[model samples]
Target: MATLYQLHSSMDKLRRSTEQMAQTWRAGDSIILLGATAAFIDWLNAYLEDNDIDRIASIYALADDVAQLGDHTNAKLNLNTKLTAVLSDTEWVTLTQDPQFDKVVTIAL
Candidate 1:
């Protein structure tokens, strides 16, 4: 089964301490959600830019969440250009129900 981890406004934690991220995610199978923090895109972009081995499989972010970022243009461009699968908030429930993802883990930063 696929493992799903929710970073509740704690993306910075993953940047500083990658143990949890590494434990739950495996490279391209991972999804990026624009949490409450604006730094999420920066951190994610930096990581993706610096590391070629770990490619983002998909991204799930509400339109409002993406708008909160100061540089939504670049962020949106990055996500759209890099990922083929982009899900909205409503689709999260459907994804969770998928047989592929049976385990949903919520991690707070």
Candidate 2:
């Protein structure tokens, strides 16, 4: 299980490389890289969801990225939506009980 710092560092590197590639107007390559980035983000999202970290560091990172990208409103909305979902007791319990997610929450917390 990766720490929050490790996940953040990985995301930052990916974003920087993706941005650099996009600046060259290489549409196909940029698209491919962006797709890979999105996949990585989705993996993080699922990991957070399963570990009950959706309301913790993951949302903070996501919101920060959204704000840095000049999408404040969408970022706020996304954070609110994910937090709301995570607040449901049943959902929270289910997530916390998942064996695959146990280590991340323990390490992250």
Candidate 3:
């Protein structure tokens, strides 16, 4: 079990790493690597929350763009799922309730 101090230190390190990755992303660096860095920051934030650490704000501040990229990717995936005929009717109905799917369908029709 990590002590509070250790948890804080880990979060700080993750925050710093995320900041450096964000700078690299801004300079037209490898997006795939930047996306992975953002995911790492998100995982760190979830870990901090699980351990009762107050570091959500810092994590978000350091990786907001990466988080946005994740959100966009998810939205696109959801849209593709809805358009594809892979899901059953029940699944399709459930997906229709999703905002991303609903938006895509509304625009298509």
Candidate 4:
């Protein structure tokens, strides 16, 4: 049987490993994430190759721009500004078709 001290040490190691994996994933450091998921490394490689990094980066950059605009100002506090941010450049029909959007509106209310 394993001693309590041995169990504690194993748990600590697991915690450290999981934390490291999460950090690497959040940082978009694909190399470390791929190493951690050794079995899925091939899938990761193929997925990355098939995906459009430039398009993804531009989308995230736009989201960051919106967030920055909302920050350092009372834009978020203003109902009109919030609506404009959420609806600007978005088709009303498309926005209405999103199922999750109702939940967002409910939460806002």
Give the winner by TM-score.
Answer: 1
Judge candidate 3 at residue 93 and give its lDDT: 47
- In candidate 3, stretches whose alpha carbon ends up further than 4 angstroms from where it belongs are 1-35, 60-109
Candidate 2's C-alpha runs over 4 A off are 1-7, 11-41, 48-59, 62-64, 72-77, 83-109
Candidate 1, residue 93: lDDT: 69
**Residue-wise C-alpha lDDT for candidate 1, range 24-65, written one tens digit per residue:** 566545454645633455575565455442544555665566
TM-score of every candidate relative to the true structure: 0.61, 0.24, 0.22, 0.19
Clashing pairs in 1: none
Candidate 1, residue 52: how far the Cα is off, in Å: 10
TM-score of 4: 0.19
Weakest lDDT window of 10 consecutive positions for candidate 2 = 27-36
Q: Which of the two candidates, 2 or 4, achieves a greater TM-score against the reference?
A: 2
- Per-residue lDDT of model 3, residues 1-109, tens digit only: 1110111123345654434333222221111112233334445545434544442211111233334546776465342332222334454345445443212111000
Q: Which TM-score value belongs to model 2? A: 0.24
RMSD of each: 3.8, 13.7, 17.5, 18.4
* lDDT score, candidate 4: 0.26
Clashes of 1: 0
- Which pairs in model 2 have colliding backbones? none
Tell me model 3's lDDT, rounded to 2 decimals.
Answer: 0.32
lDDT of predicted model 1: 0.55
- Superposition error at 10 for model 1 (Å): 4.7
lDDT (CA) per prediction: 0.55, 0.33, 0.32, 0.26
Better of 1 and 4 by TM-score: 1
Residue 92 C-alpha lDDT in model 2: 39
